[model samples]
Target: MLIRKAHSGDAQRVFDIRNQAINHQCVGHYPEADLAVWTRGELSDYFIEVVANTGHVAVIDNQVTASGLLDLETGQVDAVFVDPACMGRGIGRRMMDYLEQQALQAGLSHLILDSTLNAADFYRRCGFVGERIAQYQSPRGLTLACVPMIKHLAR
Candidate 1:
C-alpha cells in the first residue's frame, strides 16, 4: 500500500469511501435515520478544498482504499475512513500512522478527533484515549454521537 497526499480529484473517491465505511461498518451503532442523514449528499466544495489541503489517501493496487485528514495547525484529525471492502486489512492503522507522522513532523504534540461509535475501539487501540460521549455536528447539519478522543504524541 502506498500513502500519498490527496489531490482535488481524489475528493469523490474519498467521499465514496466515507459513505461506504459509514454504511457498512456503522450498522447498529447508529440509528438508520441518523446514518442516512450523515451520509446524504454528493462531494461538496468544502470536501474538495479539504482534499486539496489536509487530505491523504491510501492507495492499494492503484485504487484509493482509505483516506484521512490532519489539520497540522490545530492537531486535529478531522477524518479517517477506509473502504468497507478494505476493512480489517490494517489500512486504517497505516493511514493513522501516516497522519501521526505528518503531525509529528509539523511539531504537533497531540492529536484530537471525534470518532464514530463503531470506530472508538479502533482509535483506542491506536493510542487515543477518551470514552465520554460527544455530539458531532456534521457540516450537513446532522448531529451524531461520537467519542471525543485525544492522543499525546511522543516526542
Candidate 2:
C-alpha cells in the first residue's frame, strides 16, 4: 500500500466512506437528513477545507483504501476510515501516520478526535488517551456519546 496526500477528486470516496460509517454504525450520530446535510459537498464544506488542509489517503493498487485529515487549527482528526475489505491490514495505522506527520509539521502540540467506542482502543494504541466525554450532533440530537481522545505529539 502506498500513502499520499488526497486531492479534490478524492471527495467522493471520502464521502462514501463517511456515509458507510454513518449508516452502519451510529459513529456519525446524526439523522439521515442531518448526515446528508453535513456530509453534502455544498453544506458542511469540510471536503474543500480538507483538501486545503492536511488530507491524506492510502492507495492500494491505485485504489483509495483508507483516508484521514488533520485540522491544523484544532489538531482534530476529521475522519479516519479504512475500506471494509482492507481492515486488519494496518491501513488505519498508516493513515494515522499521515495525519500525525501533518499535524507535527503544522506545529500542533496535540491531536484530538472524538472516537466511537469501537475505535477508542485503536486510538489508545496510537498513543491517544481519553480526555473527556464528548457529544456529537447526530440524528439523535446530542445522543452521540464518544470519548474525546488526545495525543500529545512529541516534537
lDDT measured at residue 3 in model 1 versus the true structure, 0 to 100: 100
- Candidate 1 has what TM-score? 0.98
Give the lowest summed-lDDT range of ten residues in model 2: 35-44
Candidate 2 segments whose C-alpha is farther than 4 A from its true place: 22-52, 138-142
Per-residue error for 99 in candidate 1, Å, reads 0.6
Shift in Å, residue 41, candidate 1: 1.4
lDDT of 2: 0.75
Q: Pick the candidate with the highest TM-score.
A: 1
Query: What is the per-residue lDDT of model 2 for residues 13-39, given as tens digits with 9 covering 90 to 100?
Result: 866776565555553444566545544
Off by over 4 Å in 1: none
Q: Please give me the total number of clashing residue pairs in predicted model 1.
A: 0
Per lDDT, the best of the predicted structures is 1
lDDT of 1 at 9: 93
